[model samples]
Target chain A: MKKNRLGEFQELVLMTVIVLQDDAYGVEIQRDLEERLKKRLSVGAIQTALKRMVEKGFLTSEFGEATQKRGGKRKRIYSATPYAHQVLREMRDLRAQLWDAMPRLGTSQA
Target chain B: MKKNRLGEFQELVLMTVIVLQDDAYGVEIQRDLEERLKKRLSVGAIQTALKRMVEKGFLTSEFGEATQKRGGKRKRIYSATPYAHQVLREMRDLRAQLWDAMPRLGTSQA
Candidate 1:
């Protein structure tokens, strides 16, 4: 559980990062997740999760080239590592298996 | 999100309950999850999760008839409510959307 666990929020954040791609940064990730999850996410919460994920080898980040758009500040762009992709796939497959194993609703069997 | 949110563990537990049907009790749920997830889970953790889910209206439980098989002790059996099924379906759909939206691996469009 400790080695390869992805929390619900962490999974959602990682998905948002993968979907955002080149524009995967703090503000953009927060916005995308908020829009998709329909929840008001605190920037602090997203940033913390991003930091933890980067440390966990699930994601990698690099500073973009400095631009004059905001006084030459470089944005930290995030990307999902191959490891993250594998874990995500495993989760999806496991979930699918569980769903398939479920009996039809209203059919109770011990 | 607060109104209809399912944590990853909660979702998994709920799915297991549906799959295990009438046999969805504390010990069985824990064993099934540990086997499928390949992680050691504490009895306390599983029980706490079940309690929370019940409070959240995602599950319902009942005490099974006392049996001599377990020294006349009744097991508390859990079942997923309609709301749980709906939330699980929504989560599956949402994950599929994210997976689809992702760019093909190694073909970095960014």
Candidate 2:
């Protein structure tokens, strides 16, 4: 496997996980995605995507103590591995490079 | 299905499709991601990811005329759906909003 490999959704999830820090979990991730992205994401879709990322070694999850927030159900908190960060860095750099190469085509630059 | 939905890699791939315009295809998409992203992306991984995106209604592909590039093997060309573009726009807006919310902490601007 490549040292820095990630699916796009996985990258976004990882970024959200980093933003959420210790509070990162299924519900929070879902909430952040919806609120921040102005889009709706199904719990099943998020869970399935999270599971795939975990299997790909881009993410790690552990159970958290039951909380009243979920009727005492343990929330599986997720965090990005160092490898995940590395992949995200590369992706960002690549995107930034392309953006840099583009000519300013809008009045926003003026 | 959501009106706009996309994974991260799917977003990147779709962006490349838009950038590549009429020339977008498997090998070119893989090349752009690898070269622009400075990341190694296996052909199989790219192909598989593209297949999934196509199934998810994020993309559409068509068989292209074989070129000297890869003998007579048809290259499956890909293009973003209007829905894909909408999803990308939403994702970009969301990310930009987050970036905008952050206080400037770097000296690069000064």
Candidate 3:
């Protein structure tokens, strides 16, 4: 897991970015996360996690067109890379294998 | 995830203990793990993981009968607890949810 371990927060943020698709900028991501998590989160925290994932190659970011809502500041839109899904799928299957191999809490297999 | 995060090695060791059933001890566990991982690992490493699991209440250990093969030293046999399965199941389901929610690469879901 260490070779490509995605921190839990990073995993969540990456998934949110995928779900958000074209709308995955910092403020929007924070809003979506807060809504889903049923709690408030600092924009700074979400941005920090997003930045780390971009550095880790699990994500890529580009500046979007400046918007009037944000006073002419372009948002840094984020997207999950194929490499992100590749590592995620690997971990998912690894976990599935472990689950399937288990003797399931005392059945005939045990 | 942090509430009950199991280290990857610890998860493997716990599963191996359950799979080994009554035969789980330091030597047997190390052998099984080495076979599965196809790499040499120290007995001390296995024991350290086992002891930590015991402390965490994920495992229980008892001394078996002394054997002349090991110069009358008793073998400490280990068994996974229900709590171990509980946490493993939670992590498994969590991963499954993430994998399912993911839009498959280049799919319509994306």
Candidate 4:
């Protein structure tokens, strides 16, 4: 399997899409990221990541129902592809393995 | 705290260094990454990541005792700095939060 290369911000955006499930649009993902990470993020940055991931096959986006709340604009909802989940699992396993291999040190507490 | 920006390959190298602990030199880290990741990684790539991370303050290196096995040349062992651990923690927490928020779906199993 080819490795999935994701930058830190891209990974965060991808995870946010998974977390949001059916409600994952650009604005909503940005909001969720800000809330969870406690850091301000530009909508453009999120959009760029979303676009890049979509191109990379880590995420798929489709137009959702046109909502009156946003003047009948149909939001583009993003969802994690199976490839995304696979990469995430790989990342989690790699990190866990490294963490497990760490020697117990008195000075370092994380 | 400033964000520790690591690319996917860089993150893998960084984690591999942490996994190797006291034995984390370029050759050893490359070997461990190959074993765990089941993929051949270039020595140059690993060395570049180690150098970059050391410059970024995510890792520290120290010269270890020379051995006759490899012509008695001192090896520079790399270790994860507290900053690296902190970033790893942040990444873990973020991923966990996103994973927790995900709705269970029959189609997706990770």
Model 2: what TM-score? 0.61
TM-score of each: 0.88, 0.61, 0.67, 0.87
After superposition of all CA atoms, the RMSD between model 2 and the true structure is: 5.8
Quality of candidate 3 docking, DockQ: 0.35
Residue B107 displacement (Å), model 3: 3.7
Give the candidates in order of lDDT, highest first. 1, 4, 3, 2
| B69 Cα displacement, candidate 2 (Å) | 15
Across A10-79, the per-residue lDDT of candidate 3 in tens digits comes to 7778888887888999999999878766668898989998988887889999999997774778889999
The candidate 3 chain A region of ten consecutive residues with least summed lDDT is A1-10
Candidate 1's TM-score reads: 0.88
**Candidate 4 deviant stretches above 4 angstroms:** A1-3, A70-72, A106-110, B1-3, B70-72, B106-110
* True-vs-predicted CA distance for residue B46, candidate 4, Å: 1.2
Better of 1 and 4 by lDDT: 1
Worst 10 residues of 2 chain B by lDDT: B101-110
What is candidate 2's CA lDDT for residue B29? 81
Tens digit of lDDT per residue, candidate 1, span A22-102? Answer: 999998899988887777999999999999998889999999887678575788999999999999989989998998899
Candidate 1 residue-wise lDDT at B23: 90
For every candidate, the chain B TM-score is 0.88, 0.85, 0.84, 0.86
lDDT of 3 by residue, B1-110 (tens): 23454776787788889878888999999998787767799989999999899988899999998877847678899998888888777656655555565556667753
Better of 1 and 4 by TM-score: 1
Candidate 2 lDDT over residue span B1-110, tens digit each: 64334656666777777777667888888998798766688888778878888888888989888877646688788877777767666666665565454333354642
Docking class of 4: medium
Q: Each model's C-alpha lDDT?
A: 0.87, 0.73, 0.80, 0.85
RMSD of 4: 3.3
